[model samples]
Target: MEFSASKRIIHGFAPAFALLLLGSLAAAQSPKKSDYLENIALCNGPGHTSLAARIGGCTAFIDSGQGTKTALAIAYNNRGNAHTINGDVDRALLDFDKSIKLDPTYAKAFNNRGGAYLRKGEYDLALQALDEAIRLKPNYGRAFVNRAGVFLKKHEYDRAARDYDEAIRLEPNLEAAWSGRCWTRAIIGSLQAALEDCNKVLQSWPNDAATYDSRGLIHLKIGEAAAAIDDFSAALRVDPKLASAFYGRGLAKLRSGDKAGGDADISAAKAIQSGVDDDFVRYGVRADN
Candidate 1:
């Protein structure tokens, strides 16, 4: 099973030129107008903005009481995104609910809500929200990917694979979709296809630890212990605390006749995540093998 979290889909602002135009408008207007424009800009800025700043900006825009209903809904959604990133899932859910109440058709809000639910381990609620998001916007690749994550957590590999397939079909360049599909296919014993998917992600995002871990599992499944060790080591280099990588590398080490190293790695993995061995067992890998 894939141990990575689902990618959160947040709404972005318009082009920089639009912000420049807003700046010009603010310059020609009252200080109140300038403050509103600045607030909106800070609220909708990209991921570079600090979570606290983004939340403050969104709150300023929301409390100003000067925006249209649609704009207010967007502000709520943006604030919810910030809250989600800040690890305040409950607050994020409240903001998402407000956004949905204001704009019932806001697919991004639903998608984000589903991501929050996924973080909270509320699989049923996550599925409901993602299902609505996909229903509202059938072309929503991110929603499909998030839904696939729920399926993965539920151990529904086939359903997860189907969702990942639709997500890749809708957005071929989505790295999360490819990485997720790789993990799903790996668990389902489709080694070659899973390797292809992992290769595609690594080609674009070499630093992705989850993809490296997925590829490591594939190599382990195919009895390429050396390659599996290399891949798992690479994953551990990227994220040292990744229990799956440690556990997988342990298995590879054991297969390669390094009993001491294997035992140490397995111990470390268990220290990081007590259930790591069980996850490997579900993936059809075993220390006894």
Candidate 2:
């Protein structure tokens, strides 16, 4: 199973006006300057900032007409990120497009646009935007990850693996890259390598349900039914609704000769996701196996 790539948004690129303008100098600035700085702060606040506040702050900064083209582009991109997080992909795409128009060289905006397209299931467009992002910034690990997601969706697993490899090289600590490569390698029959990748991610992020699910599949393929069951159960402990885990565990139980328990799990998985069995079939497992 291909997990969604981690989409990273670039925050505002506003200069450190707050650091430069302090005390009496900041107090001496016009009210508009103060407002502009405040808006920038709110717009580019940490991830905990409310989506509505971030969007409003970016909108305010965009409407004030006090920002340079680059600043406006950053504001639009930030607002777009807020929109994307708010589940307003159409609005996010509009903002990303506007940002790209304002500054065609803004690789982050292009990368964000690709993410929006990915959300909409427009793989070709997502690939196009991500390609531009990578072209603009060759070492953009997140862009490579997003492009790999496009390849995964397209079932171009070899390309996806290559992109994941590049992303891991560029950002060794990126959990998504490691997990993604794990899944890709598992599917490609690089069982030992995939197991190592999954273990590495679990060491850093023990609660990652997807990694557990991937490792469970790896164990299942390696004929370790008990280990597969353990990993699948671990995944379910983290994400109870993960149909893939239910399905994989069912297969493991079946292989272990617990026919009744296996059938129960398979039925439960199908209840959660009707096509989950088909996914396992595609993974080279069959119910009769």
Candidate 3:
């Protein structure tokens, strides 16, 4: 959305920490070549969660002699993602670049570079990298999803939807693709279909507060003020700090004639994030007359 100045184009780190630290401790005690490679595999995993232990593990594996170019490529990519999660984006991009150089046809490295570009607000470069990733690996669901995010950041809603569609088609169970499509549809397309997509995501990930907030916005858009309020409340129960939920609930409350409650929620939302309503305004939502 054009409101990205207030809201990030990409959301959430998508991490699992316990398994990593535990594995790291265990591997540290007995550093075998096989064990080191194992750590590399987990650290640069598909999710690219960017945890510190992942970086450490990849570093260890890189220090060990790599068995193959593919292994080295994966280690570099994994370390880059670890850097990304650690907020050292410059280092992360360098690793992604190295990974690509190591393996000219490494699709995931290209996709990851695109993600790094998004963090840097280099939308055109991001798109080019994602395009190359998809071209190298047509079945790359993650690449399609990243491309979709780039399109969304550019406000190219239809193109975003198409990329999301392709992502879902490639990986029917990829939750992010479903949620991305749902959010995009909420902003510019069919509310009903968007609601359905939200429901589908919730059925799989019931505790996902962001999806609840997304569905709340859809309800608000469709004139279901009470429903919107309820959905927003559910989201807050899961994540109290979700500013978007507070902002959406505030609007829903006002629409339902709860002026005091509306004002309070709006204030809470802004206390959490100053420009919380820009996303809604960009989507054409307005106060009840």
Best by lDDT: 1
Q: For residues 1-289, write the lDDT of model 2, one tens digit per residue.
A: 4354333222223345234323344434767676777788777755577999889988987887666777788888889988987889999999999999989999989998998888889989999999999999999998888888888778788998999999999988888888888988888889999999999999999998989999999999989999999999999999888888998999999999999999888898999888888777777677887
Name the TM-score of candidate 3.
0.84
Regions of candidate 2 where Cα sits further than 4 Å from its true position: 5-28
After superposition, the stretches of candidate 3 with alpha carbons farther than 4 Å from their true spots are 1-50
Better of 1 and 2 by lDDT: 1
Decoy 2 TM-score against native: 0.89
Better model by lDDT: candidate 2 vs candidate 3: 2
Candidates in order have lDDT scores of 0.85, 0.83, 0.77
Winner on TM-score (1 vs 2)? 1
Q: On residues 1-289, what C-alpha lDDT tens digit does candidate 3 reach at each position?
A: 1222112233222233223333334454664746764665566554544376677777776676543566667678877766765678789889888888988898878888888888788899999988998899999888888888888879898998998899899999988788888888998858899999999999999987777888998999888999999999998999898888898999999999999999999899989887667766777687543
TM-scores for the candidates: 0.93, 0.89, 0.84
Candidate 1 lDDT, tens digit per residue, 1-289?
3456634233322324122323234344766876777788778866588888888988987887766667777888888888887889999999999999998998989999998988999999999999999999999998899999989889999999999999999999988899999999999999999999999999999998999999999999999999999999999998898888999999999999999999999999999988999898899888898
